[model samples]
Target: MRVVMFGYQTWGHRTLQALLDSEHDVVLVVTHPRSEHAYEKIWSDSVADLATEHGIPVLIRNRPDDDELLQHLKDADPDIIVANNWRTWIPPHIFNLPRHGTLNIHDSLLPKYAGFSPLIWALINNEPEVGVTAHLMDDELDAGDIVLQQAIPVSPTDTATDLFHRTVDLITPVTTGALALIAAGHTQFTRQDRTQATFFHKRSAEDIRINWDWPAHDLERLIRAQSHPYPAAYTFHKGNRLEILAATVSQNRYGGTPGRIFYRENDGIVIVTGHDARTGNNHGLALTRVRTHTGQELPATEYFTTMGGYLTRRP
Candidate 1:
């Protein structure tokens, strides 16, 4: 069966590679255009380069609803459209263009994390398991009928970067299996339950700001959730912004004012999360790795030489 692919970023690129390696005919690829800012993440190894290398037709457009793009989608005449990490809203007219309808790949189980950064949100919330779902695309956001779902257990040591690689790896096999089912005419759809659904907003600068007032475990989770490739969770110290790359719960427990350095080790510092509003207990996050404002990565002991002042939300 012919497939019109829509995707962007490493997630999409990996998915495209899987489709190319499979038996399906990929007719065209629709992806986002290049970015002006070099730091912008949306401009990763997009479908354009991969499509060019593979000799597949490519269209670069942010919005897929334009008249010309719609005509191109119509002309491609794809039996099905496979969308992964596609950034923009795809109108129903375009998704309905294919013969077998559109299949979308989401990073988490549907009816739970239905918006951006689902895997990160799941880990930050300390979900025991994360998952991948392949489903039929509809007019709404990620609220599609699931065709295939598989869960991966979340380990305490797993960082967002770790889960990201593991999660992207799931796409190749999940896509291959879903496309096989579609090709064999054995497609089965499970309608999503609306009551259990959660729609998270796009992660912003505020989300990355660490509140030491939060439980130590929660703060630790937040730091790991945004670690590396995404953006490190951070806080303000002595009128300077510092990025906390990683942290863990203190093994030797002691308590003080939240965000105040309570104990300093050769490798790290234990900062108190005095009492959580929800949990009603004292906890302290042991900062093991940090990055200074000068962009120098250092151990917490080196970074906190003068630490009477508390870490704050803003500098």
Candidate 2:
């Protein structure tokens, strides 16, 4: 089969590599230019570079809505289009161009997380498993018929970064396997249950801010969700931004206002948390490691020499 790929970052890079390795002919590639967005910078393997290395035709577009791009797609005359980690919405004409149509590979299970930063959102919400989905593209974004899905169990200690490496490894196999199925004239695709679907927005600095009013378990998961290589979950300490690198739910309960720097247990500093913390039945967040505004990382014990103040949502 002749293929055209639309992708960006490592996710796209891997999928393109799979196509290059397969029996399929990769005729053209479309990808986004380099980005400075916080999340966009991570997991960024260059799709354009890989395509160029293989001598395949490459087009860089922030969007696929332009006339020249549309003409190029018609010229390429591919049997199918494969997309992964594509940043913008693709118009119907573009997605519906090829005979087999567009196959989109997403990083989460469909009918649940259908949009951006899915692994991070799933971790913060404590989903039991996370995986990848390859589905036929339709008019709606990520709301299409499913072709293939592969999932991995989410361990209690898993971070977003951890799950990222695991799920990304699925793209190659999922992309190739889905293409093989399509080439064999398999058309019985699974329809997504829109009633069970969820969509997410891009992550920003505001999304990583730590809120002490949340339960300690949830806050702990938030720290893990935005763990290193991505932005660390953060709070304000003494008018400075303090990023939490590692944390856990405290072993003991304490009674105080949310955000209070209350106690030291083992190697961590316990920050009182939860709306009901004052009732003395709630566990606090035990921050184990942190980074100061100066970029110096430290153990939470050393950072809080005297624990009597507060970690605030704002300065």
Candidates' C-alpha lDDT: 0.84, 0.95
How many clashes in each structure? 0, 0
Question: Estimated TM-score per prediction?
Answer: 0.93, 0.99
Give the top-scoring candidate (TM-score). 2
The TM-score, computed over Cα atoms with residue i paired to residue i, of candidate 2 is 0.99
lDDT tens digits, residues 12-62, model 1?
Answer: 898899999999989999988765432237327777899999999999888
- What RMSD does model 1 have? 2.2
The sequence of per-residue lDDT tens digits that candidate 2 reaches over residues 213-289 is: 99999999999999889989999999999999999899999888999999999988999999988899999999999
Task: Tell me the spans in candidate 2 whose CA falls farther than 4 Å from its real position.
Answer: none
